[model samples]
Target chain A: MATTSIARPQAGVRPEGGGLLHRLFGRQPAGYLFLLPWLVGFLGLTLGPALASLYLSFTDYNLLESPNWVGAANYVRIATADPRFVAAMRVTLLYVVLSVPLKLVFALLVAMAFNRGLKGLPLYRAIFYLPSLLGSSVAIAVLWRQLFAGDGLVNMALWQLFGIEGPSWISNPRYSLYTLVILSVWQFGSPMIIFLAGLRQIPVDMYEAANLDGASKMRQFFKITLPLLTPVIFFNAVIQTIDAFKAFTPAFIISDGQGGPVNSTLFYTLYLYQEGFGFFRMGYASALAWILVVIIGAFTAFSFLSARYWVHYDE
Target chain B: MTSSAAAIPAIHQPAERRALWRSILIHALLIGASILMLYPLLWMLSGSVRPQDEIFGSSSLLPSSISFDGFVRGWSGLQVSFGKFFLNSLIIAVLATIGNVVGCSITAFAFARLDFRGRNFWFALMLGTLMLPYHVTLIPQYILFLQIGWVNTFLPLIVPKYLATDAFFIFLMVQFFRGIPRELDEAAMMDGCSPWRIYWKIMLPLSLPVLATAAIFSFIWTWDDFFGPLIYLNDINTYTIQLGLRSFVDSTGQSDWSGLFAMSTLSLIPVFLFFLFFQRLLIEGIATTGLKR
Candidate 1:
């Protein structure tokens, strides 16, 4: 936790004065040696590919052919002519907007309940967390499709309880994305765990003091708990937003890998996959990939910029 | 003492009763929510045991007549047996987990214990990669692997792990490593231990919880990964459990619904069992990662 201090241990002892080469290499050769694997990966796997994608964004590369330089044509096309790109953006944004807030709210509420110290709390927490662990699996996505099928369990429940026949939640365009949002919210365990940790970190004396001073439970939560938990909330917000933007498997599986039923669940990542692998439009997919990075970066930057106003970090 | 207690009994009795009622309400609510949360999983289990016709025909939690046909057919898989896919997944997951544990811990130790030129700068760069979307690196990495003839093999998935491509685990381990008191390392150094010896004998042994956390996550993620294998592996023989499951449904129309459910249940068993045994470590891993920062 106290990383900054640990990293500055050598500051306490001055190195003997030496030539430039000695000073550079002699002080910590083993440190760099230990870091060799990550350094190689950072260059070859991450940075190299990342930069190559930027170059590929302006090209016309298919797997079958050598990449031909196009110089901004891909970006121009996405900006102007690509209706599916716009649809994908719209769908993805709608998803991020709908799912992130809903998921965080559910996570916070459930976390608060669990923080109440009910008996068998560990069992409850583990059971609640089971979904998030399995949520991304193709198996679960397949199960989700079956559950929301026209004659599936969900529809059966609707018929039995409300005498209303439910539409095929996966097939219908209007409600298809909503089903994915529900799925996202259902897997709120990760954030709920974080929130529980944050709740535990809040000093108990603050609550007791507030209670003694005639503060109601609701007032205490608003005045003390919520403010103290803002940092955790902010962290979850950024991570979940990025995660929602990158969401693919559920939509891909639910739509049977086509992003189908008239592109209702065509998440941006799924569309990028289709463009890259399915259509062999590698350059276009690369461009789409950069756009996703930019969009996520912007969202993250905005959250951080806004965080100073609300996030209360202890001094 | 008896006289005073008897005099106050009437006053405290109602309060004690109210507390009992409150506890009962809380337990009742929690139990209800737990059932709702677990319903989908239960349904899948029941569906896997039920006959094919009754899967979608009935909404009941229990089957009227339980059958093992789904399990038998599902294990036979579409082209290869499901056992092969499970083995494939296990091999890849285990290798990746070992790679992550070894590589990430080494990297994290350097970050946590050593002071070097541009250390903070390098650390910042590593954290920056965490925020960079994976899609940004997807195409070029594919092309790189394709050029090296690593495509359609497990190398693409397994190699990066050996290089500690997952910065999240490194960050987690670094935090855990930093929490270990510097006195231990200093004392080892005083006893003429080299950095390597300190890392091997002291740091690694002390950092087991974080390492376990990283290993477990690495295994589960690799085992469940679909997009990575789907893009890289064109051959059915190289399919992981996820890719195998995907093959159960024909994208155009038909699916072996019962068989799919049965196999899906089977696929989840490993993860479920792991979680059941190591729930404490898993929860601690997540909690520590989130709260430490």
Candidate 2:
């Protein structure tokens, strides 16, 4: 950022350009014109609500009645006394750690396989990508429920092959969490597609040179491919982490919206949702929502800081 | 169907005698992985038609007997008619798509091409919004709608879309517009075309491929969004398909598994058919959009 400014301005190429300065500083109305819609929404909708929500967080505002400010009571209650919040935080943290890493690994592996010279590659790409298309589908969630049922196909097949019995994966606290993780891994298609596109950008000459030097495929991938793919991988990592935190629908549906069977799959958003919407603890829910925002913001900042170590953007 | 042969295991074409086993080994691994991935979806389809009480008891890939009752029940049994639910989804999705393609393209063109004031600051603000976690604003937006008495109507869903609630679409369109040569806009303006006319005549037509991509993504997004509809619409009569699906589970004691799966399969029909019909456009759009980026 610093180098570009010195070089470009010295070359007499202003970032704002020459002699149309009225428009440049937003001195004129045109600046406001382009932002009219969003400005209205931000001020009238986003800002007002945002402030109200922050205020509401300090109070006990159920939807039906006026809020009574409880100072830091809600926070104290949630942090120390609320067992559900602890359970939810534990489940949510485990889910994020397991699913995000697994999905990234699977995505990279599938992307590498597709990047090679394969027959009917586009067809392969499309088929592999179909899971992402079906990712949030209500049908897929419903299907997942039955597939892991006590006497469902999974167990029936298990009986035939190994004569083993299967537990109700969705209902059993032990297995429900695994089911969510696997479901997340199934939707690894988007990151895979992104990786495939990123892979294609890497010049084939790099690989050819590596191969001719008696490097094995594995060595070429680690040395040449991994370094070049770092930026794309980091981008996917951040996006997937944020997404993992917000993952609600699948867990909601599979758990039958109760987040139950011993609160094993009681994801953070689910509890926040139940509190805010189901119980009408609107104020408490808002506090929960803002805490999430803070957590997400902190993680995003941490990832950006951590990127200097691993992320290799060409610029 | 034709690809099933390739998925079969334990058999492989021989290479030179020494390398034959290695070739077979690779094929075996590849085929095994493909089947493991594909089996769940195939089972889901089969389970959807399996008769009640027998859905779980069966061990076979194919159902012992098929019944359309599940589809019938799923379609007819909801608090809101599934037809109305589908229509509600269709309306929101179509309107959202139209707003995205038309509105975002025009805005993107203005930002990329026109010598507009405050453009950079406003553009920066637009980009910054993309980073804002949506839930931070979700409650307030709900309150705003509730105060305005627009909660139950589709207005909450459709109106803001036209007002450009989504910045991703706008940014995507901006990238495409920036890639186009500036000469066309200049030529159109030289021919005495107004800026809006230039946008319509030159940019819009040239951006059809991207417009299609924006439209299709908007459709898919709005169709799948349960949260938006669930928040805005209180009355059961106004429920979208996703809302109906969730409520169906809530309202029932014993879930009609076959019916649920049947509806799911049938619902896929529209999206599947849409993709089948526009696959050429979809892929070309996706591939080029990714490449140009």
Candidate 3:
């Protein structure tokens, strides 16, 4: 996606003076040296591990064994036998489908509301954004569990007011997933802030003109604001979908690393966590990882391919 | 577009009942929405401080009497120490910021300014890699660290940051670098200043806003990261604050409600302070990233 984003600018370019070494080393090797730390990390950390994982996916390498090649066996087992993998996939898909749209709409509404006048707007911005800061913290996830716990806050409120019982929300398989959905929605600040910027970019002059023409606020928003904001909306949709799929901390922390309450909250990344670190099924985990990469890649490509109709950019 | 005079006969003053009531209604609705946005956080803060017995008592959003023991008890657990975990977070956060700011800027400089072979291909590769979810590579990466005997150490936590493994910062820096005029680099070069000198003397100084943006982001993300530390730091001795909080969950099959709640309150302080300190930049950076071309 980023490659295609950059492709337009690269072409026959002007050459620098002297030689490659001279350009690199001329007055100072300072830039290269400045980048030394990260360069070391890339060579030693990222690229090295990335390739290692690809190789590990083909080997039956539990921690106890020296990785023996077992071509496609890990893939076959995952595809054929793993009920948990299917469950995790279902949970993750539900999570992404439910959370991303809700988050986008909430963000859009908050952004629209924030775009207009409000006294102490910065304070409102800070308050709305606090959840994103708290997000994925074990503390927050723990708090979420409590908030939804049967005898906890949510139930206590319900029982007190309505004289009715509330089920074990976080522990009940029926409602456990709501906690994850709520967690994602609560952290809507990033997208909300993005939407706010997108809102600001829609020319105020257009709204002013629409008002002059006697268009109702409802009509103006639908006809003018929404159309122009499609690009930003598209961007948020793609990014949020990717983020929703990769969400781990809250699920792992909330489910107590068990994928729990009958695997109701067995999010994909959490399941990946289980296979890799918990069970030490490193090979299976790597296969899971590659599948995730492919899934994310395909969806990202899909969004970009579709974006030409929506995302507007000025030259 | 209709003329202002024709659309609103009276431009400066409010119309009688029509506009006035609607404006009042909208503002009231906005305030109601804002209150809803805030209620959850308000409840969490109150719950973290309430006595264990009183916690579920009436689901109070605000405690009648604020107790301080939660903060005290939360801050006091574990031999590894919250202060040490704090320092660990501090060291990792600060170093990661430095790595991101300096390293990403230099690389961004290469992508935005230099005319090197494979530059476009490499930039494209870097961007393409952004879509690669880290979960797939996580286990193998952990194993590599385990093999290298770097697990249970801060190296795994803090080292990859030194390498431009974080693509977003690099992309952000590249955009900022692109926004900067190339004449500055050319003028410096004409004076026999090397490309490296040009970056330091010219680019770095000018890119302060974007660099601060990158640094602030890296700090927040690193401070909050749990997955990285969860996998790498097996020993409680080397745990960062986030890892320390995970221990609050307790493995004895019984949740320590009071202690955990107390610790949650305590865990929030540094993060709260960090957020407050950089609030302006935090909003500005996020808002700017959204407004990207």
Q: Which of the numbered candidates is closest to the native, going by highest lDDT?
A: 1
- Ranked by DockQ, the better of candidates 1 and 2 is 1
TM-score of chain A of each: 0.92, 0.89, 0.89
Q: Candidate 3: which stretches are off by over 4 Å?
A: A1-40, A310-315, B1-16, B251-256, B291-293
User: Which digits, one per residue and each the tens of the lDDT, describe model 1 over residues A40-68?
Assistant: 99999999999999999999999898899
lDDT of 1 by residue, B205-253 (tens): 9988888888888888888899999999888788889988888765313
How many backbone clashes can be found in candidate 3? 4
* Clash pairs (backbone) in predicted model 3: A37-B162, A38-B162, A38-B163, A289-B136
If both were scored by DockQ, which would come out higher, candidate 2 or candidate 3?
Answer: 3
DockQ, per model, reads 0.51, 0.25, 0.43
- Residue B286 lDDT in candidate 2: 45
Per-residue lDDT tens digits for candidate 3, residues A34-95, read 44555566656667777888888999889998999999988898899999999999999999
Deviation of model 1 at B199, angstroms: 1.3
**Candidates 1 and 3, the one with greater DockQ:** 1
lDDT, model 3, position B81: 64
| Candidate no. 1 TM-score | 0.94
User: How far is A148's C-alpha from truth in model 3 (Å)?
Assistant: 0.9
Better of 1 and 2 by lDDT: 1
